[model samples]
Target: MTEEPLPTNASSGVVRVGDTVRRPAGPWTDSVDALLAHLHAVGFHAAPRPLGRDEQGRQVLQFLSGEAGSPDPRWSTTDLGAVGRLLREFHDAAADFTPPPDAVWQTAIPADREDLVVHHDPAPWNLVRRPAGWALIDWDAAGPGSRLWDLAYAAQTAVPLRADRPLAPTLPRLRAVVDGYGLDDAGRAALVPMLHRRVTAMVELLRSGAANGRRPWARIWTEDGPYWQRTADHLAAHTDDWAAALG
Candidate 1:
């Protein structure tokens, strides 16, 4: 039987083979494979399972079927809470994973083995909306990062920090995710700063990728990066307001 070519927003080759997804392997593939195995061993199956390589050397992962979450779904508070909880669980499962001294990652972020591993891009696009719940799909960027680093990135995606909407309306959703994740006062206090750093790094990453002629990155850089920059700016102006929303 022929393998089905899969449509992905990634800037890489992907295909569906039986119950798995086949993608081109990179130098960082082993690290990702180890990361997925760790997630599974720790009972976090919301991510794809690594099933080894195919005949042509493509890395095979369990195919998580379903559409990506709607761009602007009417997310109930419950749904927001669920996402936060899932993310927290993911971070917890990654807690005991011992990072390799020589571990290489797909991204340029130098390995900080001390920090918790992160999904890096656990946005709606990477989530597979199942009947049961949403599951994260891509593991290409999974690597060492802290809870604040990960959660802060998540806030950009889930709380949806953007200049398009007023900060007040989005703060409640931000609070929902933070509360759901059980982030305490200290963690909450650290969030806006992390958001600033995360967005800044992401903008540089996307801009550099585009400059280097990377696709999707090149395609997304103009719009996605700028919006996050605007978010960072808005947050800078109303950091206290955001804190008020949390309280």
Candidate 2:
């Protein structure tokens, strides 16, 4: 089988072979596999099925057929809503999952709470759109996390709370996402703050990683560090505005 390399910003050595995606495996792979299996078992089929490993000792996953990125129109109101709904389904399903006794994960950033396992990196780059529906790929980052923590990151990327983009127009899209997730009043209030924390954490991660000479993080920090720092400041500045928008 021809191993075609998959383009990704963070990880390298990912390739598609026939109907499976083969990628580097680690101590965390078993735990991730268990999480995916549980998602499928609970009927949250938007994730790829874990196919064990390939002959090359790399982890194998079902190669979902679709374009990987933000949906057409790129963060249209409808797509944002779908992203929220899908994330909700995944979180709800994950709530009942039990990690293996020896489970290990690659959670770089700690969550406010470990209520359940979550797709820590549910950004637009990891989302895939197919004829059937949307699917989130790249489960390597799957691990213990809070619902809002995961959702905040998703909202940041999908709604794209950037410093440069005007906030007025973005408010409706943020509302669309929160509403689609069916977030309650409590969740809505908490989400505003979580957005600031999540983006700030990202900036800190990049900054520290670069200082510590971490692999991809160090590399990415060199390129996008300033942008994320500016976005974090913007999120902090607009806390009240975000709260109002969610309301």
Candidate 3:
């Protein structure tokens, strides 16, 4: 069961092997491996099993079998229900797993915070869609963080609706995601403040990167800064709207 001849991209450092994918280790690689091992020990099987490093010193793992969504129109129109279900499964699987002692926090801006085992960057490409539902990948950023962190992060990455569609259609998408996660009223209500903070930090990161002479990275942040700002503005302007949706 070798991997299919899929083209590699900049965002993922995946290399193919017979029925497995080998990823070169980085600063956080050892921590990710330990975390994945712990997860398997505790019976969470959705994540890849750490098979060990390859001859090239790349970290190897069992390849997940599923269809990957291309960044095409069809993928953009993915049903909200599927997204919700996938998130719920992830949260459920991730629940009750204590963070490893050396688990390094990687998601969001570098901040001093409490430790909780969290999947920091649970974006689309980091997810694999199987018939049963979705499974996550790229555990590099998984560490101690709040469940809201994952939720808010997902909301920010979701595809926006076309101009002709009702404005803020992504709001409904957000709701569907929450409903899928089955968060209680209190948890949902708390999301308003966090939204602004998250978006603000993202904008800052991108802007700083641009100013630091990382031209390509800087351009990405500069381009995306406005979107993050708009989302923050929307959340600020419509606190009540956000509350209603969360409720």
What digit string (tens of lDDT, one per residue) describes model 3 on residues 55-87? 889888888889764432234334545665566
- TM-score for each of the candidates: 0.89, 0.97, 0.79
At residue 121, candidate 1 shows an lDDT of 77
State the TM-score for model 3: 0.79
Q: Highest lDDT, which number?
A: 2
**In candidate 2, what are the lDDT values of residues 1-247, reduced to their tens digit?**
8999998888899999999999999999999999999999989899999999877799999999897785223568888899899999999999999999999999888888998999899999899988888899999988899999999999988888888888898899989888989999999999999998998888888899999999789998999999999989999999988999998
Q: What digit string (tens of lDDT, one per residue) describes model 1 on residues 1-247?
A: 5788866665467888788999999888888888899889988988899999988998989988876774454576777778888889989988888766777777654322337778777776676767777688878877777788777777667767777777667878888888888999988888867777777777777788789988778777775767757766876777787778777
Candidate 2: worst-modelled 10 consecutive residues by lDDT: 67-76
lDDT of 2: 0.90
State the weakest 10-residue window (summed lDDT) of model 3. 158-167
lDDT of 2 at 214: 97
Task: State each model's CA lDDT, in order.
Answer: 0.78, 0.90, 0.65
Candidate 3 RMSD to the real structure: 3.7
